[model samples]
Target: MTESTAPETGTPSGATGNRKPTPNGTTPEPVDTSATETSAAEPTAAATTADGASVETGEAGTAAATTPPRKRAARSPRTTTSRARSTANPSNETPAPDAAGEPSASAEQPGSVSIPQARHAAPDEVDSAAPADVEDAPGDTVDGDEVGSAATPVQGGGGVVDDGAERPVVLRLTDVVKTFPGVRALDGVQLEVRAGEVHCLLGQNGAGKSTLIKVLSGAHQPDSGVVEWLGEQVRFANPQAANKAGIATIYQELDLVDDLSIGENAFLGHEPKVAGFVKRGTINRRTREILTRLGHGEIAPNRMVRTLPAAGKQVVSMARALSHEARLIIMDEPSAVLAHDEVENLFRIIRELTAQGIAVIYISHRLEEIREIGDRVTVLKDGRTTAASLPARTTPTRDLVSRMTGRSIEYVFPTRVNAPTEPEELLRVEGLGRAGEFDDISLTVGKGEIVGIAGLVGSGRSELLETIFGARQPEQGRIYVKGKALRPGAVGAAVRAGLGMAPEERKAQALLLGEPIYRNMTLSTFSKIAKFGFTDTGKEREEAMKVADQLELRPRDVRRPVRTLSGGNQQKVVVGRWLLGDTDLLLLDEPTRGVDVGARAELYQVIHALAAQGVGVLLVSSEVPEVLGLSDRVLVMREGRMVRHARAEELDEETVLDLVMAGSLMEGAPA
Candidate 1:
């Protein structure tokens, strides 16, 4: 598990002697203006004074510090001099300044002030204050002019203050502007990151976080703006160029070769070579080392990446970054596929990287993670920097959320008004078991009901859905559709029995990536598309047009390739295909996995409309809130057994978490 320290609240001891007397007769010597100026200039110095060990900058700036050259860890702290250098040189590769501005003799004593050790705790257990401190440390020593005059104290907590000593700026963006066909994705945006800091970019799906990263990583070139590296201005022509320049990016859907071994995937296209042949032994050794740094030392490098758990695959992605000697890492929604424990592991790796003078840029939708891991924050609204930089310590999660959604977010999951009706059981399974996957899974879906199945990754949620869909036949179960027995392992039989499934993997198993929208939409309902044994292309287009209009597919182009559409729109196409089949029972696994928030809201509406139409919907999702919010009833599963079934209204996140942690919900089963 990743360990994080708490945010310090007491006034810094270094500023004690610098305080002056107030007009009200109170002595206030703790506000040292001279020290701030001196410290601000020496951004890369590691100064340990009689008062405390004060590293001036955050992680982004720490790259300039004179640390031993070694593999980087995510959460390492920075020194005072490092912070000063970062502020001075906002570019990508600017080097550290000379020793003249380094730590003074008086501040180098070990017995002067004792520095606090960072606490090791789980991501959830780490106090919110820790993340806040990380965010505040960066701009604490900036000139008064740079500090926004209209700053307000964040509510629900005491304000966070920088100690003005030990913080690093891990990443900095200046006047970054990017333009799309008809929209400016990013406009003169400036962002800064500190080492050992989790800096969050808060914005709605299209608020330009992805665009900004794309520009930084060289996937998209900005129309205007200079990207600075370390302390020097630099531009990348492509992702490979940025990667070679020491920037590694992990996207929402990982870019890993599933067919390759973990070691091969970790070193894809850059495998170690001795002479003319690929050096498998060298690659495996390096892979093991990188995985060890990520705190997963036990996973064999020779194992196929596809066979690993989803969270494990994510770790492998990180390992790939480490293999490239990445100094600046950008992670987009890394937690989307991770469980509670895996997230903790990711945090640990972040801390370790920072310790080694590496910087990280983390983008995620989980506001709680922002509050837990973020050191600083940048809020983007409509492609503009609404909030240039906010100290994570002092910023409220609600305010950050407001900036992202353009409105106050009281709850993530909107409450559902209706309950499941007991009209009749639409589908039933008894002792459903798949060898080496899950066993003894039995559940029922009622007519017009939304039943949610919840479990951790590798706990058989997707497998169970597959079994019912006939993609994978259960070895020892009886499936009854409307009280009629059905043969196993026959997808045609299941489809004929009024059952339809949207598989977990939408890109590979669900949609025909190369096919046009109209054809892909009609592919599932070929029977309906035929007239007198001849396929009716005209009728198919009509049907496709109707569903496309209903789902708000962009451009209204039925002939466009499914791959050409955005993730959300493509998902709509997939779902529309199953819906067009007129199947009575719908099994959806991770229906909205890759779709953005706006599209997710649209999907919710569709789901409600489906339930209103009396189609039994079995919704399976890894995101707990999605499962809870959309379902009429939720069935908790663990180790392949049905643990508990509860009405959605009677359950909350905490209760669901408890059931997940307990591994079985049989004790809390609804009476």
Candidate 2:
């Protein structure tokens, strides 16, 4: 509840009105006039309007005014510079509302959020005043109120939460524009990243996020705009130049050499040298130190990069960035490949990095992650920043979604359909066992039922799915479809028995990336579309077009290469392939692995629709919540064994995680 003041005589000092003389007859302080500070420590206070309104910020940074003589300066501009910069420029990123509740032209800047300026005060800044001196430290208190600094929990790990507004901007982009042959990939993009803060970049695929990152990483140059590092404007000629200037980009597809050792990968291009000789010992020692700092000391520097898991590879990437002494590390979907516990560990590393005054540009499609680890957010849509520097935790999900997709969306799973009382079993695995991969797994998926498998990365989830699909020969198992046994090691036999699988690695296993979408979608039924042993392109495209419309494939073009589509669309094509065949049981491994929220919702609806049509669905997912929400029944896998099986309604995310993480020891507890 906000504390509001009743109306009083004379202009209220801090009530969105012109300031009147203090009750004690002291004049209001004069506004400072100076340039913005890039590295100076500024005071922390609750954000207020220039005319002294108590802007109470809430979800999505929506602001409401309150009556008060002194308003907290929440989201205030960098404390390193006083209110001087805003006064001198009058367009310092924060939008002010007019009588009509629209942003006044004088207060609005490019990429500025149109919402009223209701900046939320950090916990320590609730009762604080602006720093009285520019030279004061960030932790300095003012008028008995702790300001600009707070420590909070991130994904169950505690870390200092620095007030980003109080920190000096280390990287700034002004009206950055870039264009491809026929596309404007970035248009007048503006971003300001402060030191010691996680500035999250939010956008849907094709929203210019990739282009923006490319521009920042020196892979592409902006046709027009300013790129300022620290304080000086500089244009990098290539990725190496950017790295040399303390900027590192860790892309979703890590660029480490597989054959190289961890230490060698960490310092690939610029290995430590002494008198014109590469210092292998020095490189190993420093790599070990970096790994230790990242909380992964168990990984030996001499270990081959190819031997590391996805999470371990990510740690090596970070180590490589640190090896270059990067001040700002750009992470693109760093958590996409990580499991639950691995995601927590990643957040811990990010917090530690921020505490050391290193800035981070985090790009991800997961909104919950933005709330957990982000300090501020800049949203992009259609090659432009829709909103810049909004409070990450306070911003409503609807607001962010609207900015990214140009419309509000409720991210919800489809309504569950009740399974028939006497539904026929569509698929059954009796005593399924794959030596070293899985053991003694028995489960049944009834027609119109969705059965989900939940497990860790190495808990044999993917391997089990593949084995059931006949991609791998099981050491011992009886797989049946609609009561008929399937050949042990024949994918063709599995398909003939009405089984279709969308593998986890879609590009590598499911779809031919270089092939057109229609061709890829009709791969399973090409024989039906052939005439005299020749492929019928027209028939294949017509069949694919029907599925495309059902799936709502973007651009509605079937001739484009499968690789050109987004992650979600690629998965759709893979699933659509099964729709062409007489597939009664569908197997999905990480179906929504890299899909955005909007696409994920659509896919959920598709799955539900398939189940409603009496097609059995079986899937494996790293996200426990997804499994619980989408599945009718859940199976927990751990250490190559089936540990628990229950209806989805009888399980929750935490319970599932507990079983997956500690099920081996809890095997004796209960199913």
Candidate 3:
């Protein structure tokens, strides 16, 4: 049978540093193609896929003589028509047979049509969209110089690209410009994400990466430029429309409801229903399958989201995306909350997804992670794209860093120092026990000593930290600050006893997010800032500004609300609040959880400076390198047990992993 004629889109160009800028409302000239390339003006009444499967558009054509079109079934008002993409190359894989309960055409028929996977009832009907057809619309242009160092990342070449032929670009945004009252959030940004690639988005906190994803996710409509999705011109009305279009976005802050069960959250707006009633069993069963496929079968579908840990919650978020059958999933900082083992699991899942030909947009600040998982890289600075679609593994760290920060970052971690051997003991836990969380967790932090806890996601590191801070009462144990006993289950008591804690969940557990930065910072020493029983706003701001200055917090304005700050700056606010106090012992839980590499170095320096000032620091971090580099001592925990205690300099990453996984103390190590 002869192939049907259809629109053929031009090749999407990448942003380079030395290329001349493209004019507004226009795109660069189409890429040069061979004479054999199909022309864009060809017309047809059927959809031809990269896999060679054909979709009969609801139109009459030459084949209409013997091949009658399938009956158009009644669709719900909310139902959207499934979109068809242009073909990359003819696939031998059969397009799924006509779906059940809709329409059917026998295999012997001449014009059998394949239904779009999303619109079909059968789960197997979907294939990662045939290379989406491209649409040429006027858009932004960037300096078009090719990069030489894109292949250097140690962790992130997403998958094997077609060495024979590169995968077709599935999504492209040309000259996309979005603006607000005083800010142009996306200034002529250009991006191209190829099918089956882990395209990473990198930038400093204020960079337009978030805005760009929001545009792609349909949360924000671009004020200018063309957004070609799956190779078609589309303006998503909202996030729902984007999801319907096979573009799923997993935000850094998950959008799942805590009150909902795992399955309910997974299929929130699109629940399986029978006669308008939700089929709870069906949704749960399907969710279970998806979770299992992602290598997390232990997460029960009936479990409430509020009860899950950070990593578990992340998995639930991913499960939701898979449930949507997303073809191109945008993951924003997906590994920020994951432990080492959990990250490995995430990479494994990503690998599995890509092997099935599903593309992923992975965002992370960890350079090593980008090396391991990303196939290509796009760096955003301010509101524009600086470097676009560079090979992920081959890109050197210096180039990536220079692009993100607009300056070269010489170091990712601060200089390490050994604590004085004769330092005073500032904090001690005596048989601290939290039932079902952590047991007999006893540790001590000497003044000027940084004690780090290394553990997997469910290893009770956070719970123990909260317990020591008096946020949770231990079933059997006591907490002491400089040998002074703290009242059980009392945060105020802990604060009064000279113990301050920067919790793991910065947005929820710490900080008055909605309050002004100065107000939040002054919370720790409100009484000290009071003038003879009368609160003084001026005095409060003055003291808060002093600490904020020392932290070098950006914007340098304490009047702005804490919620307006970036993740790194937000963490600084938490630590800065403690900095305004007379703290003897500080407990930091995942201090650099969502911070970028540049900010992580700054935060490490702050912690060290504090410890050097005779303040004891007890910190928990999932990154073994971070724990080892910043700590004077290391405590390894696994499944609620403090299994090993060793000097930081004495234990390497491998040994720490061994102790954590085996849940046993090393030979000749402190019990």
Tens digit of per-residue lDDT, candidate 3, span 488-603? 89999999888999998787878776788898898888888888988898888898889888998876889887777777888899999988888888899988877765567678
Put down candidate 2 lDDT per residue, 1-671, tens digits, no spaces: 01111100111122223222332333233111122222212223334443222222223122212221121122221111000000000000111111111112335332121211222223332222221331333343334343344442221111343333345556777667787665676776777776667888876666677667767877667898766665445566666667755678887777777899999888887775668788899879878888877778788999999998888899998988777667789888888778767777788788767655677898887777776778777776666665666566655565566556543343344567676555788988888888888887888888888889988898998998889888899988698888989888889999999999999988788878778899999899998889999989999899999999999986578998776676777889999999989999999998987776556777888898899899999999877768888887888988888888887889877677778886453441122
Error in Å for residue 654 of model 1: 2.6
lDDT of each model, Cα atoms only?
A: 0.61, 0.67, 0.65
TM-score of 2: 0.74
- Cα miss at 189, model 3 (Å)? 2.2
RMSD of candidate 1 to the true fold?
14.0
Higher-TM-score candidate of 1 and 3: 3
Rank list by lDDT: 2, 3, 1
TM-score of each: 0.70, 0.74, 0.72
Could you give the candidate ranking by TM-score, starting with the highest? Answer: 2, 3, 1
Q: What C-alpha lDDT, on a 0 to 100 scale, does residue 559 get in candidate 2?
A: 93
Off by over 4 Å in 1: 1-162, 166-170, 180-183, 202-207, 252-293, 296-320, 379-402, 405-412, 531-538, 663-671
Q: Write the per-residue lDDT of candidate 1 for residues 1-671, one digit (tens) a residue.
A: 11101110112212235222332334321111221111123344344333221223433233355432322223322211100000000011111111111111234232121111221211221112111112333232122222332243221111122222233343456556776555666766667654445567665555577668767776667777545455334556666666655678877667777899999887786665657688898789878887777778899999998898878888887787777667678887777667667777677667666555556787765555665566666776556664644655455554454444433333323455555567478898888899878877777887888999877767788988888888887889788999999888888999889888887667788787677889889887978788988988888889999999988875478887776565567778887887788688999988776554444656777777777788889988766777777898888877666677888778776677666666444742421
